[model samples]
Target: MYCNHCGANQPDHAVFCSQCGAKLQTQSESTVPSEQEIDKEQTPVDYLDQLRSDQSSNHTDSEPTLPIANKPIHRAEPASSTVSVPPSGSPPYRSTSPARHLTWIIPTVLLLGIAGTLFWWYQHQQDINVQVTQLHQEASQLALKGQYEPALAKITQATTLRPTYAVLTKDQTMIETANRIHTKLETVSSNLKQNQLQPAEKSLITLQKALDTRKESIFEQEKTLANRNQDLLAVLKVKKELDQLDTIDALAYKLDEVDRLNNQEAKEVHQLIINKIITISMKNAEKLLQQNDFSQATAAVKAGLQYSSKDEKLLSLQKRITSEKEAFELAEKQRIERAIQQAEEEDLKNRTAGVELLNVDTQLNEYGDIEIYGEVKNVATKPIYSITVYYSGYDAAGNYLFSSSASVEPYDLEPGATGSYSAYEYDWYEEVTVQIDNITWYLE
Candidate 1:
């Protein structure tokens, strides 16, 4: 046998070519034996088969066996017509089958996939780098615009993307500037929270200076932003003072506002001082009034009224003083009137007396005796006249007689005049007594 692929000769009856490892085909002509060879090779099995063969088995026509030398041999094709095999020890040629090509395809696809993945990663890196640059630029712009919080956010993101960007020197400067600005803002914020207007203003000024310095150093346009922030802070402080003013008393509020204003800023400090003075004056006036010093109290209140003329309390105080003064004047007037009335009543109950007239005439003097002659007039007309003239007084019921006296003439003359005449001589009575009617007159 010969291999079709390799043309290697094989032994007869071989099922395969040994040299090329090809399968061999069986041939019937090669298996047939010649009749003489078969007769020479007959065995006892052929005689038994002839004797015991049934009619059916014999009729099946078993042909006589041929000798091996008479059998027709099947011959292989010529070597020139067979496929040639490679030389010994040479490796078999690989088939160009799709299944075999799939091995290279898998590796090629895997390589292509790896390349694509690397390319995608590179592109992603580039995109991220671009984004980082854009974010850094945006952050710088925002910082220049004085938007520190947002600028800080962008700067933080950019730093995360590119921890050490080559051009980050400027970005780093910007970040530092933003941090300084934030610190200044926080300082101002704390001062404002404490309601320290002066300190807060100072902080704002410092912040502006720092911002200006940063702008100049970095060649950024942040002065305008700094100025705007300062203006905003100023406005906020003014508004806060105004709001505080709303809740405080008028004098205190005005004083606080005046103090808050800058020295260069014109305000009504004088007016506030005057208002405070007026308030003090009013309080003093009230104190004086409470102490019952109306004269000084009125003066003080009048001074206060000069500033706050329409104050109800001042007016009420004035009214009260006027009422009190009027009451005092009325009481004094009543006291004087009562005193005059009492004096008049006392004068009406008093008693008064006076003498009308008396006349004395010719008389003789005697040893141990004296003559008396006189006319006595009655002055009181409220009673009747009783006549009794005595030089040495002796009555009609005389307990002792030293002399005698009789009325020569007597008359009752209304309340204007009444006359009587009498004479008496006596030594014992050196004085004379004359009684006209019921009125008595004594002459010494």
Candidate 2:
């Protein structure tokens, strides 16, 4: 048969074209069927014989025919159809072959990859930890060297890099220890700077003791850090006090330091005091000189000069005192001499006056033999004069001996004053008196 679509020749019994794979239509045969058509309706064995006969007959034709009846068809079969039907008791079909059973390999590979990654991470972490530890160690060393700021920076970096590293514990401890040592050193340094050696030394000792205790503790590093802070605080306090000190206070502090150090500077401090004292003394002396209390002022100047012997003020004061004392002595001597001369003149005046008599004798007979005498003299122009005479005599103790009187009227006297009167002599001392005008002279 010819296919109308492509004009390809096909067998008469073909339902489709072999080359183009197109469908063909069959025409109906009338009345008696053709022998080929009758043969197609045979039993299974007769059909097979027919196919063999057709194949043998078609071999002589020149046209290419479908070799469907000559060779067995080897078309690919479906997996389900090719599967062997196992006996009822046998195990079911397994698609996986023994050689293809690699279920364990994927999980094993994954686990190995995970392990490798974990190992790499662990090694990296270990390197980081080592670096952190080294950094911490360096910080500790800096702290030991009293480089607090730098050490703190290094420790801070170390902590940041490996905050929980196992090796960091020891490093942290060392860092803390270094901090404590730094603090103690700082306290000592501050004390020295402030000139408060005693207190500073005490604080330093306390810090050292604390450090010793901290060293025994598990958290020694932390303790050391605390101690360092304390030291800083102490130093800061001292610095503040020092800053506030004025000139006088600073000088006093220096003097105290000199005393503490037993240094030669002590002499300088003492000299300053001496100068001040001398100045004050001189000022006081000047005031005294103003008040004209030269004695006291001179003494003050002398005392002041003991401290400063060559002081001009003191020398001036001494000169003033010497001048004043000489003037005073001269005046005093002149006054004493005037007083003595006046006294002597008065004595001479008293001696030049004549003595006056109180009474003249009157009675005579009752006593034994006696002698009486009297004389008068003019005190003004004449040297000698004559006047009434009176006499009296008595025994050793004034017992009446003899008495007599003689009146010489209108007696004459010389120019210079002279007078003589005699009393009667008795056994012993006797009283005698003369009355001239109203005046009386006594002779004894």
Q: Could you tell me every candidate's TM-score relative to the true structure?
A: 0.29, 0.27
lDDT of 1 at 273: 46
**Candidate 2 displacement at residue 265 in angstroms:** 11
Tens-digit lDDT string for candidate 2 (102-163): 33455668999999999999999899878876887787676655565787788778878877
Clashes of 2: 21
Question: lDDT by residue for model 1 over 54-93, one digit each (tens)?
Answer: 3224333444332432455444334332233334433333
What C-alpha root-mean-square deviation, in Å, does candidate 1 show against the real structure? 25.2
Q: Which candidate leads the pack in TM-score?
A: 1
Instruction: Kindly provide the TM-score of model 1 when superposed on the true structure, using C-alpha atoms.
Output: 0.29
Reference-based TM-score, model 2: 0.27
Per candidate, the number of residue pairs that clash is 15, 21
lDDT of 1 at 239: 50
